[model samples]
Target: MEKKSMKGYIYLMPALIVILLFTAYPLIRAFLMSFYEDYNMISGEYSRIGLGNYKDLFGDKDFTKALRNTSIYVVFVVPCSIALSLLIAVLLNSNIKCQGLFQTIFFLPYVTSVIAIGLVWSWIFNSNYGLLNIILSWFGIDKVQWLNKPKYALPSLIIFSVWKSMAFDILIFLAGLQTIPKDLYNASRVDSTPRWRVFWKITVPGIAPMISYAFIMGFISAFKVYNEVFSLWGGKAGPANSAITVVYYIYDKFYNSHNYGLASAAAVILFLIILVLTIVQRMMGRKK
Candidate 1:
């Protein structure tokens, strides 16, 4: 037994080393750096250990805006995407024809490159000679500048995020739906229960865990929204930086401005926020 355990540890050594080097080391280093003042990346020197970085980050208008935009994005995208995905998943899980084709079509965005999708969506949202504007013309609505205007930038990002996020969510919901016993559904049909009542009483309760899972995953993903903004706006945050998120702020600070201490502080704060939210979600899920 001792020999077998030793051999098992030997096999796990490579993966453990990789995790320690890549994941654990970075997290620890970032946390430490967040407390450092006037830290030099090249020299690895700091004037002192303090909360100056955090204080400055909180005072900065750009950081505050990024936080607000990220919060709004999380609040909107998570619920909307999950609800839409659940509805579509329920419909597709039914005895619908061409289920495979529909599922494939819905999932294409997940597999496709975000850069490519963003480019396509850019054309769709174009103010002039765009598909969306052309559709709106039929309703006699004036053209709206989606990408060009600051006011509409976050909304455009939200819309794109919702569509992209649904792919994995719908897939998970479909899998969850399949796990629900068919006997319950059959019994509902035999009792001649109203479709709406059946859905509310049976289908929803059956997939409660999946819904919870989706919400947790959705919130985490939405909070770290940077790449979507990058792809959509061609590496810019948005017009006048209206759509800047927490990650974007960190990137700007660390790379563009070369403010390592401030960036680390912001990154640590983002990590803490995510950690707290995840814990709260788990507690709520347990209670439910």
Candidate 2:
């Protein structure tokens, strides 16, 4: 038994080493760097500044705006994505012709390159000569500057995000839908229960877990939105910084401004926020 246990431990060592090298080391280094005041580009030295870096982050206006924008994006995107996904999943789950083709078309966005999608979507949302504005012209609506205007930019990004993410949620919910026994629906029909009542009572409860999973995933992803905004707004974070997200703020600090310590502090704060929210979600899920 002792020999067998030793062999098993030896087999696990490689995986554990990889995890420590890739995950543990960077996290530990970042946590330590957050305590110092340093610029990666200008200075080679990292001087200890205690909690000063974190203190400065709170006073930074850009960081505040980024956080606010991230919160707003999360609020709008999460529920909308989940709801749209659920609806699509339900429709796709029905006995329709060319179901496989429909599933493939819906999921294509999820698998496509983010940069490519952002580029294509940017043109589609262009103020003039864009497909959307062209269609709106038929309704007597004027051109809308989707990316150039502060008010419309973030909402446009959210709309694009919802479209890109809904496919994955649809797949997840479809899996859940399949697990729900067909006998329940048949029995409800036999009992003369209305379709709406059957869905409310049966379908919703049956996919509650999937809905919860999709909500948490969507919320987390929306909070970290950067690439789309960067591509759509030419890396300026949209007009008036309306589309600046927390991750993008961190990127600007570390890469553009060379503020290593402050960037690490911002990253640490973001980590804590995500960690706490995830914990709360898990607790609520357990309670349910």
Pick by TM-score: which candidate is best?
Answer: 1
User: Per-residue lDDT for 162-256 in model 1, tens only?
Assistant: 99999999999999999999999999899999999988998898888889888888888888998889988889998999999999999999999
Candidate lDDT values, in order: 0.92, 0.86
Could you tell me the lDDT of residue 76 within candidate 1? Answer: 94
Any idea what lDDT model 1 has? 0.92
Where does candidate 1 stray beyond 4 Å? Answer: 1-5, 284-288
Clashing pairs in 2: none
Candidate 2 worst ten-residue window by lDDT: 39-48
Error of 2 at 97 (Å): 2.0
